[model samples]
Target: MTRRTFLRNVGLATVAHVVGCTKVIPELAALTANSVNSNTESKSGKNKLPKWKGFNIPDYFQPDPWYEIKHTPEEYFKWVADWGFDFIRMPVAYPTYLNISPKKQFISAEDVYKIDENKVEQIEKTIYLAQKYNLHVSLNLHRAPGYCVSTGYNEPYNLWNDKSAQDAFCHHWSFWAKRFKNISTGKISFDLVNEPCYRENINDTKSKTTAVPGTLYHNVAKAATEAIRKENRNFYVIAEANNGYAAPELADLNIGQSCRGYYPYEISHYKAPWVYPDPAYQPTPLWPGNMGGRYYDRAAMEEYYKPWLNLVKQGVGVHCGECGCWKQTPHDVFLAWFGDVLDILTGNGIGFALWELKGDFGMLNSNRSDVQYENWYGHKLDKKLLKLLQSK
Candidate 1:
């Protein structure tokens, strides 16, 4: 079977498992609620920075061959600041900041991993702009030297297996640490990697091993963290949970843990071009409805977040680094889920940055067919979702 077909089968199997174990939903919800309440009191006065509530600036630095800046950094940063967001998660592609061309034939690993000075200057400018606008920026390496979640690119080495790739990864973070050593942790932070994971079933034992010591990803993260600390001890490090940030590992690192909020993938990613789950068998996604013998609803959403809540209880700073449904999802349904998710995150004092600011899954300016557009920076704004997002 093709990769898409295999993934579709996996999705169907997941739904089957959820349907078969229907009784666990309420149990998970209760656990989440209790954990949220207890952790609220326990986590008091832990970190002085306000919980991150913001949007991701997508397509700015990823997928290489840089795209033209649609909106000026000043415009975007000011917009985020004026909208009351506390931070902006900038997902950057490593190649854009490197000296070597991605297509270049590297004679040696050293040639492959050189940091580019001009690119560094450009990133420094962005940080300065963010500081001027009073917005906290989380610099994230979305596409590192040897790995990227996106397809179509030929990465020469596997970040998980190649020693050179791992060293290069640490070197990149270390360079940034020294470059921005003066920036305060409250104003700038490092998100070690974006959505670190292997393509394994969520419940697979091998996937669980990513959290254990000596695992490739964990080792890389620990090494990078130590490398950054070596330059700037005050820098805040944010680590994403493995497997789409769903698995509850890496809390022991004592750094902030970034979690994803794309639960019930059928609903959040319905009809998304990038997601394929057997179009022949995929059911239309709906909030609080039955899907293949399983009941899916707000409570199920709460259940999905239980693991992250548990991590929060462990005193690890938790942030939903990426969360939001596709624009194609019915606007009302999207709002219902979004509101419930915000309620959960805010109630638990867990912060979140929506999937984007102006693209698909965006709150401020989205390209959903259902909504009437009001042009802002060449894109249309969804005032309804924007208002809801800013609402208490």
Candidate 2:
């Protein structure tokens, strides 16, 4: 979900309900498509990850159950496999599957461990379906026990400092690791958290959100990694980079790292309602134009990625877990900027997953005004964008 949608759905939890397509595959066929294998530790001593390309499945992204848990249709999976994409990152909201209080208030320390098996089964079904299509699933907790980058719901405790929250956070990861322990690491991996950043007040939407200290971030991630390993040592674990778009700090551990592609916020989030709160501040984006008081272009992009590139040189596995422009940007500008983004990432042997597959920033039904879309299987396909992504 985009920042706009998350903020809009913050207080609608009471009325939220499950809604989505009910299309189901009658039979679970044997895996016909080739799933990418997990790479071993590199000579640099960091675990290596496959340079997989695909899209994010926001099934459980919204924490308040605001959107459908499984919005992507089965046919979309077939299309992803047919298009040569090999990855699907599912951002899960823990609240959607937890047995929260009837009032649905902030989960207290005593109430955080209750498990709702039925909702969890729904998650498992979706993962297996994606796997059936030969797509490696990266299960991520977009909303964890005590923190979420999106300031929609109020978490009971601060994950960075509260021991209670940290325990609960580790509990959730352990639950998932045990739940899918039987699955092969090649078919699925666990992303510990999504887009973690430092927020003095997590419930205050207007407060400053900055990067957490490297040591604190490392401690939380290391604890969570140990939690997952205790349940199943073979479970491949990934810790999203601190502050989402920055370089990862957990190179001492065997877990992989995930990064973001939404650099130069002016381009990726141009005029996005949640981003540009004041319309007068939203500048018309240009590929090589001056943005945020600097000349922005491919050279600037290369400079931006220098830290990530340096991390890869040290033998750490890295992937762009979320990258794409909001549909508000002009189509031509989006393509030009995104083309460079893809080129730089792929040229460095890194892979990326577009923020979504169907809505807003996606390959189908993006609702952008400037693109001439092609009709494919009754869905409007962004052929130009697709060609660009497929080429990478």
Candidate 3:
């Protein structure tokens, strides 16, 4: 469909354009205007803005090519700050930080694995950017190598079943705590794992229930967190359960005062072909009942997300760290969802980093250029959606 026709159906939406130092973020401006319906400061003076509405920057928009060499953090973050994002979520793969087989023969590896000198340097770079921009930065371990959202390695990672691997993971955390401990000027934090998925579904041959692995994964997180705190007294640390999304009822109450947990929901992944029928067709155009009203929206905050939001109010500081409906979920649905997300996050005390700055389903398309952002299957970013987060 032509971009004009698609947008006409939605009425007020536009892609964010970076025009040098300033950005023509028309999409966000529109979302702020329409998505939020309530008054910010009450005439009588009672309402307040909650903290969970913040956005993220991680593997999706790192300054350097994640798979290869180093890059400039200052130049990259300068662009990030231009986008009006309040925080940066940097997802670093631990293996990239260190070599696979540095000194020990613990695991059978034909090659070598040593920590890259540039990796931590880049981390320090991120810390500097965060401090300079007044942006909160959460350092997350995106790939633990042996475990992740899906099976990428041949070893059949069972982080719950393997005690040795778990210990190895803990040791890595200890090292990180010691090295980057000073990076935390209170704005920097350590996120335990990017998306700790521990399920038999990785095999496809095994029938898996969601409940089993999450429990074990949380226990492992608890252990790793304890190990980190042993060294750094007040540095902030975030732990995520097996699935990316969080459940207030399931959280371990013993989490440290300075530590919080995050949850990852596929508000952007609904009916998304990535999780649906054929992995080839990406769901777009905001089909009638497609995501219907889910649009990864704000209304969900009142009903579906209350459990998680309550935790943040209780001081858990729950973070979605990752959230965004398909760039083309459907205008009405997108507006509803985006508005709800803003209200709920701002209403409570949660902090969230959008799944990306730009990409397949990001706020911006890859190459940092402006193409129509999809609100549904084929729909592009509309002004209405962008305005949601910007709303008072």
Question: Residues 305-382, candidate 1, lDDT per residue (tens digit)?
Answer: 877776666666777888888777888778877888888877787788888886677865566788877777776788
* All candidates: TM-score: 0.80, 0.87, 0.66
In candidate 3, how many Å is residue 77 off? 1.9
What is the C-alpha local distance difference test score of each model? Answer: 0.64, 0.75, 0.46
Q: Clash totals for all models, in order?
A: 0, 0, 47
Ranking by lDDT: 2, 1, 3
lDDT winner among the candidates? 2
User: Which candidate gets the maximum TM-score versus the true structure?
Assistant: 2
lDDT of 3 by residue, 259-312 (tens): 122111233343344244453454343322343334532333466566565555
What are the per-residue Cα lDDT tens digits for candidate 2 across 1-392? 35433222222111112211122113222222331212343456332678889999988778653444545678888899999999999998788887764347466666678879988888888888899999999999988887776745778877775777877888888789888887887788889888776556766656665556666776677778777766566666788876544545677666678877877778888778776668577778889788768788999899988878877777677888889998988888888999999999888888899988898888899989888999989989999999999999
What ranges in model 3 sit over 4 Å off? 1-54, 60-73, 82-84, 100-113, 201-209, 213-215, 241-267, 270-273, 279-301, 366-386
> What TM-score would candidate 2 get against the native?
0.87
CA-only RMSD, every prediction: 9.8, 8.9, 14.0
RMSD of 2: 8.9
